[model samples]
Target: MTTVELQRDLPADPERVWRALTDPAELAAWYWPERMAPAVECDPVVGGAWRIASAPDGTAVGGRFLAVARPLSLSWTWRWDGEEHESVVAVTLAPTAPELDTPDGTRLHLLHDGLRPEDVGSHREGWVSCLDRLPAHLGADGSERA
Candidate 1:
């Protein structure tokens, strides 16, 4: 199995980044731009389920929460529409140091494991696109959008 590992130092704080991950509205804002309007159901608790379905593309992504630690880390199972196997996604957030610049910033680390090697490229692109929009959705103050 292959793993897709990505680390991004975001302009927002850890709390704001956490909200973007678990909040339905915040997710809809940046998850998939292809979805004009997304139907999102997110329950950020252990054993909880989360799903996001898009309209035009008719694509859906879902999974169950395996672990949840608010404002810090979370892990879940991930399976996309028409996909047979499910991957494990683990995310960790930490505060950026004063030296790295962006004083009130967050270092977001995401790990998606259990993927076939053929699936890595697409998964990497998908995640990169989604994460690129996260900063904008985090808002200027970081908390307002939460």
Candidate 2:
């Protein structure tokens, strides 16, 4: 299995980043496509089923929360039913200290694990696209690392 970790320094605060990650509206603003549902409905608690459906075509992504540490960390099962694909996505938000070299902002660490070699390219591309849109969606120009 292959794993990919992506990191980004967002200009927004931890709470804002958390909201963007968890809140339906904020999440759609960045992560969801225009035709997709504007709001995501899911019980974020551990073992709770989480589902995100896209509009127009109605393609959906399904998963379950494996862990939650509100505003800090969230680990969940991720799957794409149309493609019959599954993986684990763990996200962490951390506050970095003020420094000249370091970007002063919230750090978003994403770990996408258990991907097959053939699926790696697609998964990486999807994440790259997602992160590319996050800055404008959050109203902040942040730097992302893949």
Give TM-scores for every candidate, taking all chains together and pairing residue i with residue i: 0.92, 0.83
Question: What is the C-alpha lDDT profile of model 1 across 1-146, one tens digit per residue?
Answer: 99999998887789889988999987887887844578899999999999999887778999999999989999999999798999999999998886785667899999999999999999999899888887777774435322
Best by TM-score: 1
Model 2: lDDT of residue 22 = 77
lDDT of 2: 0.78
Cα error of candidate 2 at position 40, Å = 1.9
Backbone clashes counted, model 1: 0
The per-model lDDT (C-alpha) reads: 0.87, 0.78
What's the number of clashes in each of the models? 0, 1
Q: State how far residue 57 of model 2 sits from its true place (Å).
A: 3.4
For model 1, the stretches where C-alpha displacement exceeds 4 angstroms are 34-36, 140-146
* Lowest lDDT block of 10, candidate 2: 137-146
